[model samples]
Target: MNQNKRFCLALDLKDDPALIKKYKEYHWSGQAWPEITDSIKSAGISDMQIYCTGNRLFMIMEVDETFDPKKKAEMDVNNPKVQEWERLMDQFQIPLPWAEDGQKWVPMDKIFQLA
Candidate 1:
């Protein structure tokens, strides 16, 4: 049996409403580039979802037990399509003030969970 792990991360969109709109449009159902989605799944991520409130963005990512974030990052660094997508998306993204150097999405600590 394969077990999956869930990780929650947070990011911020450029404060401009126009940029936010474009960001959401890019992520709309079936709107993401095939290469990007393929890379995500191939990285062992089973599912991912992003939600936004105001300028804040939250992501819920589910991945298999063998998923290694460092490995995924290394893969992304070598993938031209992923790099291209990142560059394009960077225009609408503002890394969290508290994010580490070169980090886009900041991982959120799970503080509470009923289940």
Candidate 2:
């Protein structure tokens, strides 16, 4: 598993039911998951899955060791479609109670790995 170089990211959704409904609608409207999965695959990611439970979204992405996070960030920032997607989705996202301002999605740190 270590050799595979997969990373997991977890994020929480707003507790409000209306916000959750908006979030799901926005996500589904853009057909985002499939497109994002395709983009990651084309960028050399081997496997990916996103799951939601109790207002939490967890993403597991299997990426090549050479994958460049900086490049990915740049692409995301510069893409108009991505920008629009974020803008639409941002309406429903609420920062965690302890999150810093302007931070809605927080990345979980990796603490353990399986053999």
Candidate 3:
């Protein structure tokens, strides 16, 4: 199997069950907005997956060797579609308390890995 860098990040959903259901719906492949996926690929993300437990969400992204989070973030800032998608998603997402202001999907520390 090929090896790639993986980034793990976490965020929380609004506590309302209805909102949580809506959030999950948006993540369904059939329901996902294509522009968002396109932007991710253009940002050098080879694969992306999201998981949820209760209101907490965990995102795993497999990125190309050249992927740079800062660069991707800068690109996202200039992409109207990406901004729109983020605004729509903001309805259901909440930053973790430990996250700095304006931060979303805070990066998680890697505690262990199997070799």
Candidate 4:
């Protein structure tokens, strides 16, 4: 990644225990995670990491300036494999009340970072 690149995203989770359990099962079972991971890579992101604590899921990705969030979002929507993966995941997702319509995962704005 270029030194100037920046990437980060945050996804608020559903407090429902059932939803959390279901998400864990799908991710650890390897039924759909590999494809989803690969799709992100195919889109030109790097050094991605996912973290969950309590009801928040945070993802830090390394992406160059050329990366366009809208384009990436469209790629995810256009890919059948990605679409299916998302469909499987919809059951576990809960939209945040503060988010705009149809937004599930909300991006975090960077406030400060150390080099």
TM-score of each: 0.96, 0.69, 0.94, 0.79
Q: What does candidate 4's lDDT look like per residue over 15-90, in tens digits? A: 8877887777776635556778788777777657667777778778887555677888999988898889888777
Instruction: Report the number of clashing residue pairs per model.
Output: 0, 0, 0, 0
What's the lDDT of the predicted structure labeled candidate 3?
0.93
Ranking by lDDT: 1, 3, 4, 2
Superposed Cα deviation of residue 35, candidate 2 (Å): 5.0
Using TM-score as the yardstick, the better of models 2 and 3 is: 3
Q: How high is the lDDT of residue 23 in model 2? A: 70
Q: Which candidate's TM-score is highest?
A: 1
Q: Poorest 10 consecutive residues of model 4 by lDDT? A: 1-10
What residue runs in model 3 are displaced by over 4 Å at the alpha carbon?
Answer: 1-3
- Candidate 2 pairs with clashing backbones: none
CA shift at 76, candidate 4, in angstroms?
A: 1.4
> Which of candidates 1 and 3 is the stronger one according to lDDT?
1
Better candidate number, 1 or 3, judged by TM-score: 1
- Could you give candidate 1's per-residue lDDT for residues 1-115 as a string of tens digits? 7599999999999999999999999999999999999999999999999999999999999999768999999999999999999999999999999999999999999999899
Residue 63, model 3: Cα distance from true site in angstroms: 0.4
Output the number of the lDDT-best candidate.
1
Cα-lDDT of candidate 4: 0.75
- Which candidate would rank higher by TM-score, 3 or 4? 3
| Candidate 2 lDDT tens digits, 15-81 | 8888886676655544566555556666667876667777887778788866776677677777776
| Cα lDDT, all candidates | 0.95, 0.69, 0.93, 0.75
Residue 18, model 3: lDDT of 100
